[model samples]
Target: MKIAIIGGGPGGYVAAIKAAQMGAEVVLIEKEYIGGTCLNTGCIPTKVLLHSTEIYHQLRNEAEDLGLEINDLKVNWRNLLTRKELVATQLVEGVKNILRTMNVEVVRGYAKFTSTKTIEVSLTAGGKRSISFDKAIVATGSKSIIIPVPGHDLEGVITSREAMSLEEIPESICIVGGGVIGVEFANIYSNLGTQITIIEMLPELVANMDQEIVNSLEEALLTKGVKVYKSAKVLRIDRSGKELQVTAQLGDDPFQVIAEKVIMATGRKPSGDGLGLEEIGVKVDRGAIQVDRLFKTDVDNIYAIGDCTGGVQLAHVASASGLMVAELIMGERMAMDFRTIPYCVYTNPELASVGLTERDAVMKGYKIKVGKFPMYGNGKSVITGNVRGMVKIIADENTGEVLGVHIAGNSATELIASGAVAMRLEATVQELITTIYAHPTVGEAIHEAAESVFGRAIHIP
Candidate 1:
């Protein structure tokens, strides 16, 4: 069988590899570099900076605790970006190596369907070709949403991609969205000593996340001096000398902001625009491609995954979707279970959650009991001096089954997976509470939270 995967992102690349392993002749088409936006710009690159900012912040807080005196420490933006680029390059090369080792043919170019069974490729390095395949996967991912406000094309205004390769850090930045990407950038730049003010049209930042988690990170951002504006409409933007003049309406008065640079993290939509989805007999519901439970579009022998499908724009979600599609191609029947998928916020006090929230459980008609555990009560949290978070678990009140787990604090992002897996396996609160946790670790918070479900918390009063 001949398989063609378009857009070498997490989904496309993973699908290509899995197709190859399943003994199919695969051709992976990439528009620019391999790994698409995730490695080249989005998930991996931002995470690289997030790690650096985390370490930088840690060192600043550690000097007193570790009793090491230092002076005049400042972030070298050049060095920091250099490291991010290096990491991105390494991962890009790694993905290419995986493809080559698996004998998957990689065509570097933009892919669009000229017919139901043929795709045209326009190479970045100057070549045009066409490939005929028996099967194809569309995973073109997404691009930043650009608005038609005045001065939209100003040199200082940039998207998430341009924001990643910034040659120099700006003195002050005005981000146009207070969603996940916007807030993440706010934290990254603020920690790197860039003045950041996040403006959101919504009532709160990360309006999609659970309200409890949102409140937690909001407090953290305020403590770190990030200026947040909510429910404000941006009217226009113009370049004024060496800065950007942004005109926004906050209630009655027209609020003006002057910043050295502007970033539009206003969210992204399916970049399936111009791909000729309509011309090729593909159906698009709204801005995203329509897909069934198995990621199959209306057309047979054609599959769509990742950002193009638009259910969840997360990299891991795309990866999981890829695996599910691969399994379906192998004649396995399964649904993409997102109940155990974890979400993380990389701020100073990290926020992470898996499964339903207490409110979600209630909305779903589950009579639930909540377990709460504070980090201040844990020995490791106090010893490490990062005692500013909590773990809470919601469980079925009558059946004693764990419904969902929510966390806000350090390393909670990595810890919630345990709770998520238990939830998936239908593990009761008693099962997790009885499970052995290692001594002197933050993960023990799970046990404490579970214990508190029945008002038997040992660590906290």
Candidate 2:
């Protein structure tokens, strides 16, 4: 069996490897470097910078409390970005090595479907070629959304990609969106001593998360001196001498903020264009490809996954989708369930969640009970002096079946994995409470929160 995968991202690359492992001859095509945007430009690069900034901030601020005296430590932007680039490059090379080891044929080009089973590849090195495959997978991901506002094309205005590779960190930046990308960049810049002003048209930041977690994140941002403007619409951006002036309307009043740079972190849209998907009879909706439960497109032998499918834009989710599609192609039938997929934001007090939120559970008509334990009650959090959030568990009131878990605190991203496993196994609140959690660990909060469901958390009361 010959399989052709387009877009060499987490979805495409993983699909290729899995298909190869399943005894299929696989060809992976990529236009740019491997590891895709997640490793090259988005997730990995951003996290590298965030990690550096977090360490810088922690050492600078927490050193006194830890009885360590340090002086005049500042961020070296050039060196820091160089390290980020090195990390991304190394990971890309690692992916390439893995693909090579799996014996997946990697074609460097842009793929356009000529027919249901044939595609024309416009080679990046300057030649056109065609290939026919028994099956194909489209994993074309997404690109940053650029909002249309006056003067947006002016100098100093940039997207997340450009923001990551900035020659030097700007003294101040006004981020235009308050979603995950925007808030994360806000934290990154603020931690590095860059004045950050976030202008969000929504009523709150990261509106997709639980309201309580959002509140905690908002409070943390405020404490870090991030100026937040919610429910404000950007009217225009203007070049004012050396700085950029962002004009926004709050209520009936219009105001301006001057910053060295402007970052447009509005969101991302599926990048399914230029591939002739619709021309080949595959369904494309609002820039995203439509796929069935098995990751199969409207066409029988073609499958789509990741950001292109518009189901979930997360990298891990894309990898999971890839694996499921590979299995289906190998004659093992299965469907991908996204309900328990974890969502994480790598902030100082990280935010992570899996399964339904409390609001979602109630909306779905489930009678739910909520258990919340503040991080301050966790011994490890108290010992580390980084207790600024809580762990929340939502369960079916009558059945005690765990419905969801939301966490906002140190190592929250790692802590949410246990919650994900519980949800996947349909584990109940009682089961979680009965599970032993090692003392003085961040994970104990999960246990304490489960106990809190029964109003029996020992730490607080």
Candidate 3:
């Protein structure tokens, strides 16, 4: 079978590789760089900066407590950015080599659907080419949303894409939208000595995260001198001299902040333009391509995944969907399940969650019992002097079934995977408690949290 996968992102590339491994002829098309926004501008690059800033923050603030003397603790922005670029390039090339090894042909071009099984590619180099396939997978991802506002096109106004590769760090920046992107960038810049003011249209930051964890993160950001303005709407961006003035409204009051740069971390929308999807009768909801559980579109031979499908705008989710689609095409019994997928945010005090949140479980009419263990009590957290968060476990009250796990602290992103596995295996709180955890480790908080669910936590009074 000849399979054409559009957009060589996590989803498209994984789909291509999986199909090729299944003895299918696969060709992947990408318009911009491989690995998509996640690698090029979004997840990887941001984390690189975050990681660097974290070390800088530790050296500057915690060095004295650690009994270390440093005369000149400074950040080389250029060198840090260079390292980020090198790492991204290496990973992109690694993905390319893997695809090559799998014998999947990769074409650099923008693919537009000419028919259900045919696509015309406007090559990045020059000219155009058309490919006919027995099956097609649309993984064309998403782009940063640019809201229509007065003076939005003014100089010094940019998106997350531009924020990643800034030539010089802005003295001050006003970031609009306090979602994951906004909060992460605020953490990054604030630690790097950039004055940060986050404006969110909602009542809270990271509205999708556990409210308790969100509160902890918000407090942490404020403690770091990052200003947060929730329930505020940005009215306009006006260039004033070398700075940008951002006018915002909160309730009936209007205020403004002048900064060296203004970033629209508002959100992202599916990038499905020029695909001729409508003409080909592929269903599109809002800006996202609609797909069933198997990632099948209205057209039987075509499927869609990734941010373009709009179920979850996460790279790992996209890759998982791609694998499921490949298995479906290969006549395997498979379906995409998102119930226990992990969500991670790599800030200083990271936030991670898996399975149903407390609110979701309550809304679904489940009688849930919750256990929360403070990180300050964890031996490792106390030893490391980084204990400003906690772990929360939600379980079925009667059955003791692990329902959800939320964490906010050091290595929380890494620790959330255990929650995914526990939920996937339908493990009970008893099982988690019985499984011995290593002493003097942050992960022991998870074990303690499960024990706390039944008021049997040994470490806690």
CA lDDT, every model vs. true structure: 0.85, 0.92, 0.90
Off by over 4 Å in 3: none
Candidate 2 pairs with clashing backbones: none
For each candidate in turn, give its C-alpha RMSD to the true structure in angstroms.
1.8, 1.0, 1.0
Better of 1 and 3 by TM-score: 3
| Displacement of the residue 286 alpha carbon in candidate 3, Å | 3.4
- Best model number under lDDT: 2
Give the Cα error of residue 369 in candidate 3, in Å.
Answer: 0.4
**Candidate 2 Cα deviation (angstroms), residue 330:** 0.9
Per-residue CA lDDT of candidate 1, range 1-461, in tens? 88888888998899888878888899998877689888999988898888898777767768778677779777888888999999999989998999999999998877888887999888878878999988788888887888778987899999888888888878899999998899888888887778888889999888766667678788877877788889998899988898999999888878988999899999888876567777888888666888887789888888899898777788888888877776677666657677788887777677888888887898999999999898888878777777887889999999989888888877887887897788888999999888999979888888999999999999887
Worst 10 residues of 3 by lDDT: 331-340
lDDT of 3 by residue, 186-294 (tens): 9999998899999999998888888888777888998999988999999999988889999999999999999999999988999766688989998887779988878
Which rank order by lDDT, best down to worst? 2, 3, 1
The deviation in Å at residue 177 for candidate 2 is 0.7
Report the error of model 2 at residue 411, Å: 0.4
Clashes of 2: 0
Residue runs of model 2 more than 4 Å from their true location after superposition:
none
Give candidate 2's whole-model lDDT. 0.92
Report the candidate with higher lDDT, 1 versus 2: 2
